[model samples]
Target chain A: MSPSPEQAAFPEAFAAALREPRSAIPARLAARPGVDPAVRFAIYRNNMAAGLGRVLADRFPVLRRLLGADFFAALTDAFIRQHPPAGPVLLEYGALFPNFVERFPPSQHLAYLADVARLEWLRHCALLAADAAPIDRAALAAQPPDVMARLRFTLHPSLAILRSPFPIVSIWRANIDPANPAVVPAGLPGENALLVRPGLVAEIHAVPASRADFVERLQAGVALGDATNLVGADLTAALAFLLSAGILTGFFPVSDDAARRSDPA
Target chain B: MAPRRIPSLSTSAVPASRPTPAGLSPPAGVGLRPPHFRAALAEPGAVDFLEVHPENYLCDGGPQHHFLTALRQDLPLSFHGVGLSLGGADRPDRRHLARLRQLVDRYQPFHFSEHLAWSSHGGTYFNDLLPLPYTQANLARMSAHVAETQDCLGRQILIENPSLYLTFAESEMSEAEFLAELSRRSGCRLLLDINNLYVSAINAGWDSWAMLAEFPQDAVAQIHLAGHDHCRDADGGSLLIDTHGMPVADPVWDLFAAIAPRLAGVPVLIEWDQDLPDWPRLVSEASLARQLAGNALAEARHVAIA
Candidate 1:
């Protein structure tokens, strides 16, 4: 038999009920003589909130630790209700969580907390970002002098750089590192992070403020010589660090890249 | 006492299954989580097969994709998806299906399966298997979504029965009847989650054996043996949550023993998602399932001969 016409909107009604704790349960759910329908319906509520909260907690442990379990749970619940996941890949979920915390009033006192969440989020993304083989110095040496000069080098897909007003790297390191938990020096102008997943492991290196722009520009598809000249800082150390860390994927001539982009096909 | 046959919606049109790996025989598998990756890699023969939630490996490339690539070389795979939202009114997401197709093409998994319940509503993915009323409209919608998913993957996908906390009063048929008709209409197979069967039976007040008897037994292709937790719901009434945290409880094992005779060559996965045990402990649990299936199948054969 067909369902009741009213039940046509069942999923929508059910979702609304689950999203709002104060909303009454849908009318049609029934249990046997002994079972309580309200209690049974709550299973969905608890599971939805608890499971999503667990994902947030797992992804942002420092946020959890910093906010403490209770406060983190409250914040997660608020975030979950306001901004539920838009996609099935949960790893892609909560991209806005860092932004959410930044705007959250309770966490306003912890200025670096939002940056830490951003760092953690980047680290999480790095761990799962698409794998790409980086060209070693040998591969670079194979390129001719002209290609090397105007090389529009492709960086590793996992590479990300974040600069924050507060010392996010020191704070993150202090929270995650147990062996050498260094005291986070407060009131610093900022600290920069260079994230790369060279292999399966994701590494977060502290980048100098002066060189962060150069690496970001390179990541944004700027050619090597132009990016270096644009920054016009002591970029030798940053370039050396990128090479040593295997962040350079491959490179082609700038003019060749421009020609390909200009082609309609 | 048999399930009602939908003669109009017979599975005659269903495509034949692809050739499965040799490991499918004597099949007992374990869910390979990240914690056991090293151990699972080191010893490929710990189980005949390995099952994983395809949602976890939907990303382009990672150590997980690498590990699955390596592991697939030695053992067969069962890709159980958790996010398809097959029972939803909306069509299955084409992008998710495309990614799944890529994985299927890349790995050539022996079996691909999703649940009968929906997990997405509107745009938000709830991330939990949510139930539906057992009505013909829901059934038709589910069948269409299942067919779309199977067509997209270019393979027959099994639909698993979800453990429900409460039954819908608006239902027009039994869960078994709903699933039977769904399979008949969609030409899909069934992944009989034995633990879910036991949990739903007790919570919804049914004789577990009677409930099991009502299932479309012939369509059953795979089995899931998992653990659950017993707790009081808000009303302080007994409730069994499908937590998959601990080892398989005795009652669920009893249910498995009863059904194993029907699952001769089917791969049974020991699913422990929460409170994860070490690799050795997981191996031991899988070994127990293998042992139980073996003994049960042997007894069934002996009884038939007698």
Candidate 2:
């Protein structure tokens, strides 16, 4: 339908008032006796910022704790102005927050904040990920031993592997739980986090670097033999951990030719 | 005031064969917040029904889904949408409509509702319920969108009146007229939010009682009561923001007392979305509403006999 002349101007004007800080209320809006158009518009601005800010705080609680409430409010305001939600689902609104923090000028001093944000984002995603039944151990053990080597496994939908140069896991843990005694040490080695939702609750486990490598390769659809070969760590222990955690939901045997054909360039 | 006989409106366009599960009655209820989930589930009879914003539970599986599924089995559910911009220039987003359809099918709520304001525009969704002009073109757009949404969901939905901060110079009709016309053209019902009516009237310098008198009460299927915050504008004029952070104000409760008799048996909801009180306090608010509704029904009956 063709936009009416009035309809054409209303949204454009209202949107400008919302986006531009303290922009004069559009000519289309009327001021009541006591309510100035500008002040009324400010309420909307505050509401938009505060609503999105609350969603950000809920998704990135550690970020909020790391940056005190006032600073976090300012950061969320900036983020809101730059990247308002693209859709109605607030749960999925902060996908780009981690990248935004990475490029954020003021946050440059806190180099590890972006990685921590990424970890939090992963946990948020895992919490809302699709539901699936875990593979039964007996069903998998019944397969032939030779087939196990060529077997390709499907990871549960709520699984994410995050590798960061900073000790993001320790930072997240310490910040999320104040009672935890694990202090984030300076000059510490990086950490790998395995995020999974085996049941209703999502959990992040700090895994060894080798296990991260093995899981990453397995997640990429590599067969068990290839994934184990790629990791120099104890294959049996990693396999046991994966099986016990119920991270592997299903597996299918693959022929050598099929595996070679499916391999990415 | 004498009892007004509301005309029997045709609500049969939407199928009514799928009755709500046994034991669920459309009495007064409260918006189900996360904090009160366990309490609400534990005491299913605490409220007549429960209202929820579908946007909060769009995810596939989680504690939210688990709780809502368990609650729906016992309590009558009402899906109140805060995301669908029925008044936007664009037709309702197809993907959002599909998700809403999925929710409606799964829950089979007693009633479904969305605001008569726009939240998204030009591909950017503002979290707040933004106001719009009540012009002919905008009215046409809103009516068409409402009809499309109803057809998409294969059921009737209610369009609610929004609390306003500013009015448009281009608006040619009052909010009541706009809502009545929208319902007339779209075959949808109205969710008369008395708190919103009071807030908008006070903000826009209109008479709340007059607006209530002109409201299309017969077309109303539900009523919402919530609290607003008192603030000052730039010129030191009073501004009431629909914060929904406090208990229902006395003035709003008075308005409810005035209108409840006319809207007998309509499901009323007490919405305390922010700074939510404890579960017992919230349920107490619903009890107050039930008492007021009961008195209204009795008054209407007395007038009928007289």
Candidate 3:
């Protein structure tokens, strides 16, 4: 016979105690009569605390490096206790960590840390993202002008945009790349990043703030003409960079009626 | 959330035909890590086969898959899962089952294995493998879950004996008996981890070799050899922790040497997951495993193998 819901409570209690240090070892777990469960139970505790700390550390190398080991470990303990992994694919773990860092009291002083973490997470995602085919320029050219205006793009699976009030691009570069000794400037100039993996490696481009509006609109699946109109300055370079970067997977023209349905009234 | 449906990379990634290399008899396998991708490809015959944790390759497509696609053309592959909590009180996650099945169908590896221990409960996956009590009810739960996994995978998977730290008072049967019955009931095979048996037996105060003598060897389909760490318990008593971070300790190697005769022709994997050495060093460990296993098979047949 399988465990009854009452019996099933045993593992539930065990898992609960694994997360909470204060809880006594599930009363049923045993060693020999003289042996204490504390020593054995500590292995599972360390596995969750230290094991998960390593996972989070691996995911955010730049953040870990920036905060130093002691601080990272301190923050990571709080992070793991609150956000243990929901599934087995560890690659997908730590998605909410950036937001956690944003609210985390200790990291609040390092205002740029969250965005840098966000950037690293994107790079992590890009490392394992699916292969995709970019839009065919020749095929796109054959479409009518009116149809092209209302067209929306299907971005690559790995594409992500991060806009921050701090110079995250320079911070990420200075810390991560060994050869690139480019020092971060003193003034906190806001930066926007365009991230997409062209092949095996994901590339980060620091985009002009003026074009941030255009990128945001397009990402929201806004029509091409409308997205273009949102930006005042010339977008020739930005458009070229995006088109050449393998960011757009495909494109489709949305009818006015369909567009309205997608948007809120 | 629904598991995203992505295009299958198998048809696109893998080559139509893979070349088989002639090698020394009875292969030794090594866990393929990112650090050794280039070396594995550069010298295909260095190790006879490669094993990977399927969870690491769960993504859609990338360099790891890129290299594996190329390496598959040169050597055989095995998928050892670390996440399918078959010993959990609850049923296996259908989404995890589906995703794992997708890889199994794509790779078509000869050996697939998971631990008898449960690593997830109440929807949260503990990164480390956790112990399962060996009660009749727990045994029934594990058997059903294993059957469900096999039915979904459409292939036989091996269950490994986890390295454990403590015994459960709730357990009504011995771990060996539980594993034997699990295989008998689930119609699955075993992937015996020699290091795990050594570590667990010592930690639980049982004689390691005596437990090995009682173990059900006929059910084994694969073998794993790894290292453990020795530490003092709170009471200052000796404790063995299965870290898989160190080189195969002398005792484990001795255990493997002793048991290799019983497991002739089985693929042996050297699993060093942490503090990885250079590729050449890891391959040497694989070579040693191959030599020990090969020598055993040779003696059994009374024929020398080069």
Error of 2 at B13 (Å): 14
lDDT per residue, candidate 2, B1-306, as tens digits?
443333242322121111233312226889999889899998988887788999988998877888999998777788899988999887899899999899888887878999989998888999989899998888998999999999998889999999998888889998999999999999999999999999999899899999999999989999999989998776777789999999899999888888887776678899999988999999889878877766665666677789
Q: What's the C-alpha lDDT at position B91 in model 3? A: 89
Better of 1 and 2 by DockQ: 2
**Candidate 2 error regions (>4 Å):** A1-5, A178-185, A230-233, A255-265, B1-26, B234-237, B303-306
Clashing pairs in 2: none
lDDT by residue (tens digit), candidate 3, A38-146: 7788889998888779888888877877887899999989988899999999878889999999899988987788888899988888888887877788878798989
Ten residues in sequence with the least summed lDDT for candidate 2 chain A: A256-265
- In candidate 1, how many Å is residue B93 off? 1.6
Model 1, range A2-66, lDDT digits (tens) per residue? Answer: 75664665788888888898889987787756667888888899898899999999899877776
Fnat for the candidates in order: 0.67, 0.73, 0.72
**Which portions of model 1 show Cα errors greater than 4 Å?**
A1-3, A142-147, A177-187, A230-235, A256-265, B1-25, B233-237
Query: Against the true two-chain complex, what DockQ does each candidate achieve?
Result: 0.61, 0.66, 0.60
Higher-lDDT candidate of 2 and 3: 2
**Model 3: residues with Cα > 4 Å off, grouped in runs:** A1-9, A32-34, A135-152, A178-185, A220-226, A230-233, A251-265, B1-24, B234-236, B300-306
Per-residue lDDT of candidate 2, residues A33-152 (tens digit)? 755677777888889998899889888988888877888888888999999998998888999999988888888788888998999999998888877778768978897878888888
